[model samples]
Target chain A: SQQGEEDPQALSIQEGENATMNCSYKTSINNLQWYRQNSGRGLVHLILIRSNEREKHSGRLRVTLDTSKKSSSLLITASRAADTASYFCATDASRLWDDMRFGAGTRLTVKP
Target chain B: DTEVTQTPKHLVMGMTNKKSLKCEQHMGHRAMYWYKQKAKKPPELMFVYSYEKLSINESVPSRFSPECPNSSLLNLHLHALQPEDSALYLCASSLPGQGPSGNTIYFGEGSWLTVV
Candidate 1:
């Protein structure tokens, strides 16, 4: 499977705390993207890091990619209750085709 | 607010019924996709259409037929579906190419399908 694997299937944290999720994939990728999906909702693109880039940050989210390790991580700073959602890491394995595969995702809960 | 839009936010159909889930995007993205997501699971790629052409099928079952009428519109024609086929159908679009902007896929709110 081209899908990535995410650690900590579920995580619980309080507001003002930081929540981190890690992902590992098996194949070479052009880029890795992180998405957030609320329950029964559509996914929202969070950030994207290329294989050449090590780290990228967007607003309260930080994403790191290590192609050598075939792993990536996402960190949400100052988590809020509204931050509760499932975070997924997607890998674009084929450069010619849009064959993007997704990880199982990490369910995050932030308490007020 | 996502630029991609999907119709029939919720659908309930029988095994013998035939239905079509509609998706549209005005962003002028050359690539469109359909994804099936089960409860608590990640979205599975069902089909990909680039430049209004079927580029990848992902070996999807025949019961799920994907159609791209134009660059801005995509549809999934469902027929004789099993109960297991019930899932959240997501529609997405992206610019066709590499790089951050090209790889970034914009998804619709999704349609909830329930096969009875």
Candidate 2:
């Protein structure tokens, strides 16, 4: 079973625009992580935000966590055509220390 | 090395054929995982090995068997698979134990399997 669900299943935007993807989970989580996957390859870890943290940034990527609302969002500033890929949100539930469940994912296409 | 490597990048097998998927990581990660992903779907957890011990099975079918020969290697043996079982097999690894930090998991380029 998937613990998280991403909104806006698909999004398309022009280069230089910003892309934002949201995720909502059901249970309390110790942490939430965002990942990116190219067309036929495995996923790559993007960023991780702890439950206690509100927001974090890496390069042009920004991630925000809202534990009160059980939701998180990932924002890509100055999106480029290379940013086109599928993004997933994985949650490590507070109850389970070893298992992490991934969401359906958001497919973002950056048009050049 | 800090990467996970998987062999036989693509495989085609018959229902009665028996084959195996191999994964190796040199990062010394104590936890390894196997995940199955169908087209356009999120990868599903299949098995997990921690410290060279089987920790989680995820209720996977009997036809699939997982092996951890050492801390640096994991293998999944497949047999009697149906056509519906065709999908990408992904291997991943992360630091041992739980934490809100420094436990970022890394994945390898998945093995594309086609069952006929």
Candidate 3:
């Protein structure tokens, strides 16, 4: 089953703008990881934030986790046309490796 | 390559056809998983194999059988599948040694299966 849900099923932005997408889950999570999937392709790992950490960043991406709300957000600063893709957030429990579930995803289309 | 590889980028089969999806990884990982996704839904776990042994099965239908030939290869056999079963099948692998604190999975270029 899917453990999380991402809001704004679709987001369109102009290049050089910032794109923000949010995800909310239902259960306690050990860690949350974000991924990017291009049209008709596999997924690529973007970033992973542990339960102890509140915020993390990688390149042009920033991720924040709020355990109380069971929600997380991914912010892409200075978005580019190449950043156009579907983003998914996956939650993994602290128990086992297979105890992970992914959210629906948010489609971001960045136009130049 | 730092990636999981799945064979047959695209597949089309009829309701009575029998086919198989293959996945390979050379990342020296101990665990592999199979996930199925519909048009706009998220990937759902179907099976998980750890240390070359089937460890997790999500009560998936018996018509779908999974096989692990070796530590580097996995296969999913499809038989008597419904048209609704057509979707993107993904394969992922991860080193499940560090527990949850460091659990990360790498995915392959999923195989798009269409059952007509």
Maximum-TM-score candidate: 2
Error of 3 at B99 (Å): 1.7
DockQ (CA atoms), all models: 0.61, 0.66, 0.70
Residue A101 accuracy (lDDT) in model 3: 83
What 10-residue stretch in candidate 3 chain B is worst by lDDT? B95-104
Model 2 chain B: ten consecutive residues of lowest lDDT: B96-105
Off by over 4 Å in 2: none
Q: How do the candidates score on chain B by TM-score?
A: 0.95, 0.96, 0.96
Candidate 1: list runs displaced more than 4 Å.
B99-102
Interface RMSD after interface superposition, each candidate: 2.1, 1.5, 1.3
Q: Tell me the docking grade of candidate 3.
A: medium
Model 2 deviation from the true structure expressed as Cα RMSD, one decimal place: 1.0
| Tens digits of per-residue lDDT for model 2, A40-107 | 89999999998999999999999999999999999999999999999999997685556777999999
Give per-model TM-scores. Answer: 0.96, 0.97, 0.96
* lDDT (0 to 1) per candidate: 0.91, 0.92, 0.90
The TM-score measured for candidate 1 stands at 0.96
